[model samples]
Target: MIGEARRALPLRTATSRLVVVVRAASAADYEPVLDVLVDAGIRSLELTLTTPGTIERLGSLIERYGADADVGVGTVVDREQLSRTIDAGAHYIVTPITSAELIEQSVTHGVPIIPGGLTPTELFASWSRGASAVKVFPASQVTPGYVKDLRGPFPGIQVVPSGGIDIDGAAEWLEAGAAAVSVGGPLLGDALRGGDLRALRARALRFVTACSQAPRAHRSAVPTRP
Candidate 1:
């Protein structure tokens, strides 16, 4: 499985230490948006299925930039979408919530799955199920401080903080403990609405540079007492 060859920590799969979440009005946005980000040296892209014509767009992107870019699908909520993403050659799959069935399907299909969660219990549940990584979602609800705290209990778990991550916040999350940061509107803004490619490219560069400086968390765990 080409996608299965990623590192144990999902975020480590990205050279930029950033997963740029792209949401667009339609399939027409895939090429330009992804091209700008990839050319800027950000290889990880999560194209949310919420966009129209995602199947075709995902396939096309995989055929075109799949060699250089780590292209995947986001907002996958059900098994059906999971199957479709795999068949389309998605490098990975991300869901807003942790679903055992989704995880199982990803396992069955041999693709990686990043499930979303809020509480410690939810996050742990996802991790225990073989998720590629756990996404602490709506990150606005918790600060980077929370990620540091989570380390105390779940030291070995790979985490990616998503939702509402701003330009200046990527380093904050990385420094605190995020394996990578997922950014959407804060990075793309109007460019996703057909605004400007060059500006989006610049923003992608800024984020890549920001994440590059933050120290990465190693995969380790607190050993249990025998």
Candidate 2:
């Protein structure tokens, strides 16, 4: 499955370092918002499917940024949306919830998929189906300690904490075992509404710096019997 997907969609460069999800009102907002993230050294970005002219904007980003940025579509729910995202040149596809058909489509196209899940069962289910990673949505509802616990059981699973994540919360999530963190409002904040590109850039930098400084906890070694 993975092999087939790669041939069709061609995975973007590793986004495991930093993934930024931006929800904008219009296509005009994408370039500036994306510039902020790219300036902050964030290579991965998700332009929500709900955004106006999503495919058009996706195509523009791919055409302009090329390999300099890893652009994808988020909030994708069905196979139709998935196909359009790929057609628009999205490097990956992200859905807030799992849809096997959508995942299969992404694989068929060769783009990576990140499906959202809140519980252990859901997380495992997504992972078992070949999700490149699982997004832990409404992450604020679950504390960092919860992430630590989940990691204990699924050590290799790539967990990305999504909603309610700020710079500080992003640091906490990474320390707790998140492979990466996605910041939306906190990073974009009023920038979109107010058109404050400077503030947006500053916020993105803060997030990047925080993630860089956050400590990764050492996994506890299992006891060896005598």
Candidate 3:
């Protein structure tokens, strides 16, 4: 299945411009955390490996919601972690830093991988290594213009902003040429902290709406997952 992921990635990216970061506060928080978002029409989902049992939980998620969303693993930093994630049926892999070994592991498996990077050198290196995309970490510390500036030198690289992005900031990132915007904390807000699912649903819709209204040239905010 990993072998087919790369071929299908572009289609996946074109439609999924709003990737939600799912970090479980506890093992018990995992399922409900995903249920509300998936039910809210989130198509692109990233389950961070930083959470305990995430690698173990990835399989069940892929089994239960794989049909409704793209269940990928994030914060993956090494070949061992990458291997475990792939074996757990991850549809895509994400790393917090560029790792040739990790990228090679993913590419060897034919699985789509998004490696994180902040500098131009790191981002371009990932692209040259056949990364599915580059995740721009700590995006909240910078403005959307930073992404535009990055594009000036490396115009063809695909970047997805991850971290500190709120619903309103989603569109600005997209408008600035980010292939997609990965949101957590701000978007997840009180959900993981035991907030009402109804309120979470409402917030999810707002993020979705903000993403949907961005210029179509940025990327199609498809409501469905593969």
Q: How many backbone clashes does candidate 2 have?
A: 4
Candidate ranking (lDDT, best to worst) = 1, 3, 2
RMSD of each: 4.4, 5.6, 4.4
The better-scoring model by lDDT among 2 and 3 is 3
* lDDT for position 210 in model 3: 85
lDDT of 3 by residue, 28-52 (tens): 5788878888888888888887788
Cα lDDT, all candidates:
0.79, 0.73, 0.78
On TM-score, the candidate that comes out on top is: 1
Residue 211 alpha-carbon offset, candidate 2, angstroms? 1.3
Q: lDDT by residue for model 2 over 61-145, one digit each (tens)?
A: 8887666767878999987788888888887788999667776677655567888889998887776666767788878788878
* TM-score, per-candidate, Cα-based: 0.90, 0.86, 0.89
Q: Return whichever of 2 and 3 wins on TM-score.
A: 3
Model 3 is weakest, by summed lDDT over 10 consecutive residues, at 217-226
